[model samples]
Target: MGKSHVLVIPFPAQGHVIPMMELSQRLIEQGVKVTFVNTEVIHNKIVTSNWINKDGVDDDLRHMVSIPDGLDPCEDRNDIVKLAKSISQNMPGKFEELIESVDKEDDTKITCIIADFNMAWAIRVAKKKGIKPAAFWSASVITLASVLSVEKLIDDGIINEKGMVLKDEMIRLSDSMLPMKPTNMFWVCFEDPALSEVAFQIVLAAKQASELTEWVLCNSTTELEAATFSMYPQLSPIGPLLASNRLADQTGHFWKEDTTCLAWLDQQPACSVIYIAFGSFTLFNQNQFEELAFGLELSNKPFLWVVRPGMTKETATIFPDGYMERIGSRGKIVSWAPQQKVLAHPSVACFVSHCGWNSTLEGVTNGLPFLCWPYFSDQFQDETYICDIWKTGLGLNKDERGIITREEIKSKIEVLFNNGMFRANALDIKEKVASSIAKGGCSHSNFNKFFEWIHEKDS
Candidate 1:
């Protein structure tokens, strides 16, 4: 019997990479060999960080490999979309070559690929050979359904020459319980002829995604999105992948993780602190930043905020004068903190979030309630599920220009904190999330099924 090997690739970003890493870890635990591919630039960053925290990842069972992303490393993150567009034309041959090199010395066949939804090129590569490829959507199932529905939207002319342009009025989708104007699927959903050309290139990539032997795999659990799962049985829901009580994946980041915040949380009362983060990529303008700062202060609640360096162009000027001092004793701020640890802390009561899926799962698993502020992509959909279907979170309604004010922030926080009803509901859902990931649970069973499929047929 030869070794069972799988290649795992994620869309090049922080939130996307983390879940793929978790899934890869699980595959390794089940006795499969794994190769995780990141761009050279991202790979270098991980390597430097590896020296700082040797315990973060198992260097033996899993290996990190790199390929040229076909983009200049000098470009900033905001320009990543344009850079990614360029890669579609260039990376296929490079990736095929890399696969050849891996196959040369080993008896293991490149049996299957589990790639991010954005990495649709892998489907073509897998099909060109005899291997299998499956797209993994590390988000709520509603989001995957929404992205798939974009083709339906295009056929309906809901999108204009601008590619799903929104008028000042909110446009509602039939799948959505609430009204939300359709916008960019971050950049791939645009309709501008030039951008649509890029978008069409992506659709060219996405449409081929279903050609894989296995179908889409989402990180959400079935109980959370029963309607979505019922509609697309092929889109398997195997997630909320946390240990009991959100206690797992404490391996920390590629970099040395600081635990000062955990010590700080110990002194706070149980479920009394509001934890605020905007996932990895969402950014705020100065006005919105000050508004959030003032709103948190005005809410008169103890709060912990993760304000990353890339969060704003004018981050230094965004905070109000004496703002840190005004909330001095009650506030804790860090450029970055061990997020999973902070979310699981006893004092972390509520979350003010950008509604990214990873954070959504973490919050639900921990039983913390939410104040949802969605930015882009499927975040709005995640927000809808949190506030509407899940009954665990509240959404922020922005104006025509998408600006949310301090008063709105303060009012929502007050409503969330004072409403014993909301907290109870959030906690109730939390228990369900925990149960689904437990032994003999739905997600657990689904994972085992996936493992067996890979081993018996593909591997």
Candidate 2:
């Protein structure tokens, strides 16, 4: 190949796509050509507003292509189980055709195929086409480690092959792993038996995908998950793959950000604003939603909250009567806030987040402590680390009803602000994270190592 070139395919979701896009930009910076592929639905939504005018995606360095995800227009793309089933079954042939067409059209043969860990079938497709394939896990390596250990969990009788816990027991995968309850796991409550089984199948696919790859690129730093990295020697941590200042304005958003939030932050006193946003998938019950609103009101602190539509169970986001006028300018709520921007603002004291891996990393990167009210899955795991291992944040305990009341929210915000200890710890992690992604840092060196592999002849 004249120049190292790779085709990057991400499982179509906001969290997954953004990091892959960032990785593409990084590769472009290192003189590699990238054909960034997306599902036709996502491609059509993002093509105009995001990539075309984005600074890092230049004509000569990178290109965009899309294939059908096999989801009908009427289907819910956010339905995790359905999305997994449809894409896994329908897209293999379409992806194979796209790869063939790209090879035929480009003078330079594609050197590598980097696919999301969820898309295990891509490895087979790549092997058939005479290209190298690598797995990319977009979440925290720590979380992926838990996932990769599911089989071991089954072997030890902690969980079955289907990821069902054998009984109501506390289980530990490794000494470094957090103690997990049998019932609550991953990012959300899998209380629904049907949903849990389907969710487990997706994890099985991701694990199989991991075993097939000799190379793996993760959107995390070794500093973030040292023990996890030691356990899995193949994973290469080269992330916190944020869009730098040059690409910041251009990086695409699945939802339009309310730019007004920036000005709102300006009016708040330093370190007085609490920033809240649950990433793409966390849904709140009507009770949870009203409680969150009441909690924000009780805090008496300036805040910015991102409430995306469909975030609530019923899609009803109505506030209590006189809710806006009561707080006036003290609180600002938007359908979507420019999260990276809001977190980095000087006035933002802490984050009331769902503890999604991306949100966790962003909070750490910004030196802000967390109010961890994890809704489900690996988030509960992440909360253990933030509160126990890292000592960088406080988690809100659920009430007798298993709900985090307004008082709990208010209390956590007070704890983060009234105390200097956790804030100091968060800043320390921030320094380490920033240094890792900086020039001559660990992630940068790892990126070089990864690039060297990309340039090598395929076996």
Candidate 3:
């Protein structure tokens, strides 16, 4: 007779938090009492960013809570290995305590726990508390399949127990997925051996935790990866979880977005502006930054680029000499952007992106072609999906020096523009994604089933 209560937790990264927050909003709309949890540092950023507007008196069923990530305020939260280790060690006990406190303060009891697959320890804690557990994979289903295939990789001797690649070869998990080099495995992609080992252990833990989950939800669609979904029937495709789908402003940004960019986009000619943005955590050396700048200049096309703080290794992002004067009015650069709106704008042409899953989905849903410049980890795999599988994008080739030259950037932009097929493919994928979330579509059916399951009295 009481409203079902759910506790939602996401890995404390921008990409992970946004999708999980969107899912929480969906649950709220369904009349569920939801508690959304974030790390203390991330929560502070969200609050200061003013996206949530907690002061507005509206939804009493929804709440946002934060727990310490076990790091001091001055610590570098950007270091993935350190942050991962700290959360694994410190957050579990803190999360359990939060649950106990919430029960004492609220009338509804938490009936289920939905956690990011990366933070599978929450699933363990949920089980220990006799709460139903579900795992949400924010990235592509192919990536999830890869993470769950750690044991098979070890059995095949492709990787060692510590997640080191023993053999340098291309392998495919199934005929449905793309062939990838052994070295590119998510855990093995780290440059540091110690970091790779820790990442591997985390992956192993997630896979083990998955076995205990009652439901496995993925922010993907069978339309995009039908073959992979067929291979792993457990993954339910309920995503492209964007706020735009529900006609709401996106939340969970670590940086405040610049709305002026939207006005600048409106002034540009239709399909004339190049939109470039790398997701949070991408860093560039001074050389690459300069080259990217000159490349955008050489393209001679109107462009909007997001140069987030700390994007470059140098203390400050330095443009080429007289760069601002030379490209006056032709270029617009902002520290952070309203990406979903930018992608949806008619003036935007194509995306020059780092190929993070969130950016990939945004571009795909908006029917924009891509010029892929993947940096590391799962991004490389995402590029393969964009360029090879979907044929909606082209990859930028780095020179022998491992820097993408200005000429290469200019050339790829020209190629992407000249080719109509890429846009056609992009539009085609966009239509499929639209249909998937529409009534009677696969994602719609899956979401309805999930909703029913969550409301089940026995669950």
Candidate 4:
């Protein structure tokens, strides 16, 4: 048999794209020819960032393929609803063209199209071509399982076009298998039907996923989602795909990651600094910003925070009067840091994260406990596993006005830092993750099974 040619596409966010790249690399190591596809805009950034060198891969065997994303590079990233709608409408034709053009030049036919579960357009195109289509959901299995429960949510009035029911609300889901908070399920609170419509498209895509292939792959591990698997047995759990020794040589993100923070970490005491990043996509308003500032100051712990410009208010520059001076020599806040490197540092003790799947896996792989402040999407679900199931993280509460108080923030950080049981639990998950990524571990076996399923599909 010739090389099994695979085209891997992921949602063009930093979190989603990174794992797919890792998976692509792993497939290539298994003698599969890989083509990693990103939107043209993101691809341009990848090139300009000088992250992936021309000599990064063999002259053959692997390449980057970028097609039109139907939006200009300067378009608004905040208009996620619009962006998602446009991509859903337009991506199929471009995908078909890309696959056809590649297949025309090489006899190794496109054996599989592994795509982000959000990118539903690929499935129809793959079906048309008589090729295997595998959907890779970067979120947790429980989140996907919850998403599959959307109709039930609508029926129970747990979710509506305006917003979901609040955590303390009377509405209940059909099963406690995917217990959820209001903001956790989907982002439809803007009172605009457009957001809900966009959300519907995402759900449609996920619901259709169960129909598209038997090989629905999630970037999660069985160790993490034993409960989710017990609830929904059909889904595949092959993830927490962190360093795994293979990604050590791979390129970083499309933007240059600041390494000075690592130098700062090197100077701190062992397990001393709190690593805080809400991820690249999340932003806060002014009130929330001020609270976090005072909270971190009051915690009296060494911390490193990545605060992007415009991440808070129009007056984002004015964090607080003399706040930085108060935390002098203890806190280092920058725009963006090399996250995986920072988390891996021994000086980094805990992670205050949004619980994005990629960051969660990175946190676990580095043996860092968490202060889980989830923002949107499946982050709350991931946080549920981290805090509730895995006993490795803690959650923050918002007031009636949606503000997380400085007092609450300070308390949670202190608890997570001082609690011995939290540390022990985090280390246990860390060791489990280590073994899973080790040779002939559970993830490795699942990966082999993934391939065997694909080959069996081919045969």
- Per residue, candidate 3 scores C-alpha lDDT tens digits across 252-280 of 89898998999999899999999999988
Which tens-of-lDDT digit does each residue in 192-300 have in candidate 4? 5677667766776667765877677778877777666666667777787655464353343666666789888989999889899988777788888899999999888
Off by over 4 Å in 3: 54-58
Off by over 4 Å in 4: 54-59, 151-178, 187-192, 244-252, 399-401, 455-459
Assess every candidate by TM-score: 0.89, 0.94, 0.98, 0.90
Model 4: lDDT equals: 0.78
Clashes of 4: 1
Note the Cα lDDT for every prediction shown: 0.74, 0.82, 0.90, 0.78
lDDT of 2 by residue, 248-353 (tens): 6435467777889999899888998989999878888888888889999999888888989888888577787899999889889899877888888999999988
Better structure of 2 and 3 per lDDT: 3
**Candidate 1 residue lDDT tens string, 1-459:** 556788888877777777787888788888888888877766666666553133333555576787988877777645655767767877778889888987896567688888788788877787887777878887777656645666666666665543444343444445523455555354433334465556545654675676555757778887787777777778777786543333345432444455687888999999889999887677778878887888889888898998877688663645788887789879998877778888878898899998988888888888888999887777877888888888888988777767887788889988887888878888898888778878888888888888887887643
Lowest summed-lDDT stretch of 10 residues in model 1?
243-252
Q: What is the lDDT of residue 353 in candidate 2?
A: 89
Q: Clashes in model 1: which pairs?
A: 163-191
Clashes within 3 Å, all models in order: 1, 8, 0, 1
Kindly give the stretch of ten consecutive residues in candidate 4 with the minimal lDDT sum: 166-175
Task: Compare candidates 2 and 4 on lDDT and give the better one.
Answer: 2
Task: Specify the highest-TM-score model's number.
Answer: 3
Off by over 4 Å in 2: 48-58, 182-184, 187-189, 247-252
TM-score, cand. 4: 0.90
